[model samples]
Target: MTFGQQLLFFFSAVGAFNGLLLGIYLLFIKKLKYLPDFFLGLLLLMLSTRVGISVCMYFYPDLPRIIPHLGLSALFFTGPALYYYIRSSFQQNQFDVRNCRKVFGILTLILGAVGLLYLFFPVTWENYFGTFIYTAWSVFVFITVYQYYIFSKQKIVSHNKFVLPVLLSNVIIFLTYQLISTGWIQVYCAGGSLVFSFVLYANFLILFNKKYHQVAVKETNNRYSNKKISEEQADNFVSRLERLMETEELYKNANLKLSDLASRMNMSAHQLSQLLNDNLGKSFSIYINEYRINEACEKIENGSYLKIEEIGYEVGFNSKSTFFSTFKKIKNTTPLLYKQSQILTEPRFQSSNL
Candidate 1:
């Protein structure tokens, strides 16, 4: 191999190695064990393995035959891992055993089928399988991108601006590799190793920034030590908040944000956040959504002619899925079920009157 080829190989190896380590650290060492973190870690590990093996097979063709198959298996999981990571990032529920079983079962079936095919089929057939895998992966990526777009439109609080850049990196890597595979580009050995490196490092930087902000907040809190307020002040804040919501019906705005509410109340965002957390012991989302859910219940009980989905939207939910999920979470039952129970009670009351 020429010096240029050797240099690319070295850089690719370094990226893959660092990615593998980062994935392990995220999975094992990260204190906050969020489900999304696990999925992201798995994605990073799979990507590193796939890239490392591909680089190895290119530089040392005499390596064992099993190496390529292992890499292909890792490649097969990349899209699914990424999709789940994005999905779980926005979810509020804790990851449980049931979720683990479902994800693992599906992954097992896919890998098992691929393994069987490789065991029985001619070596050349694997190329056809690669085409199908990549095509499916592209479709999944598009679906994920569309999901995020919808989230953005709805102004979901969990939608992180950083997620877009990470997703874009994935899309770019996939497209560049696809172009190279199809002989549309002359780049040597699947481009975008540096891009993958950038993404991994970017994640680290985000994490660092978050930690730094937390520490800074802690220091400020220690110095001020006077965030507490009297009961009268708390009541005043609560009354003002309620009056604003009652008068303006701001809760009906599907895209309402904490900062928007804070601005309307003539308070700094941090002050508003602290008031909610310290006084009410509720996050802004929970407090706002409680009002929304209460309004939904009133609509249901009043026998409004609107459909359940319409009622959800009218009460400020941005999407039917989110509305149902949050309603179930807060109300301890689904909207349709709650409405049906209310209807049943109404008939009993009418019969009693008769």
Candidate 2:
């Protein structure tokens, strides 16, 4: 094989290997909901990009144009799935069929349209459609980057750094291909640059995955370091804590403190703090406040009919102003507004299912 062919082969191999390893890692994490769908989408993207390049070189003119169409279509899932995965990470629930089906449904439509178009088209038309598809692909990626920025603003740590480089690399790759098609660049430079772009982008993906996984593992270890429990044991402990907090009234005590809770749970304060911070992804104060705020909101909106000050005091707030500020920060609105909305919605809810 020539040097260019070898380079293509290397990138194809790297892309495949990265996809395989990443899929395995995501599957095994077991904590990330909807990870399987995200991994499957990404694997399709990797295979599509690699195989598209191969078809362009070795099989072009002889290849059915629909292959490239299928490949480019995979880009939609790869970018959007990454954003979806990030959003899902913020919630504790497992990923469900309803959400995954939404993505697959859109992909099905795109693929169906492309196939119908290809069947009625000629070679020149297919080439034009390919360029159009590439343009659409680029736009899709740009939108994903923007959406990811919004999610990162909500404080996802991994996305906080990785989106920019990957976004830029993808744009550059698309532009290089466009230039080549327009005959502004030599064929070799165009293809070589595109391959190089994927390689760099793949490296960014690997680094991002590494940083995220390392942080997750470190946080998990910190939570279990004192008793040195296995990861499964630590997960069980944290799961039990979550369940107890939800079902038992013990955590609702106004006098509850980190040390007190730790002693009751037969664990050290440091360990408890780690579990709250790492596993639950919040500081101890924040975690406690979340529960307190929810309880206060309940009293305010529900028939508890307590005064704001009384609700605050009941939920462990030292002062009404403190409760007001904390509640506003968490719920992004004033207590009175929340109460008014709840009041207006109550009759509708009572009369019919919400």
TM-score quality measure for candidate 2: 0.50
Estimate every model's Cα lDDT from 0 to 1.
0.77, 0.61
Q: Compute the lDDT for candidate 1.
A: 0.77
TM-score of each: 0.64, 0.50
What's the CA error at residue 152 for candidate 1, in Å?
Answer: 2.6
Q: lDDT: which candidate is best?
A: 1
Candidate 1 clashing pairs, residues 3+ apart or interchain: none
The reply for model 1, stretches above 4 Å from the true place, is 1-6, 29-32, 94-104, 159-161, 206-352
RMSD of 1: 8.0
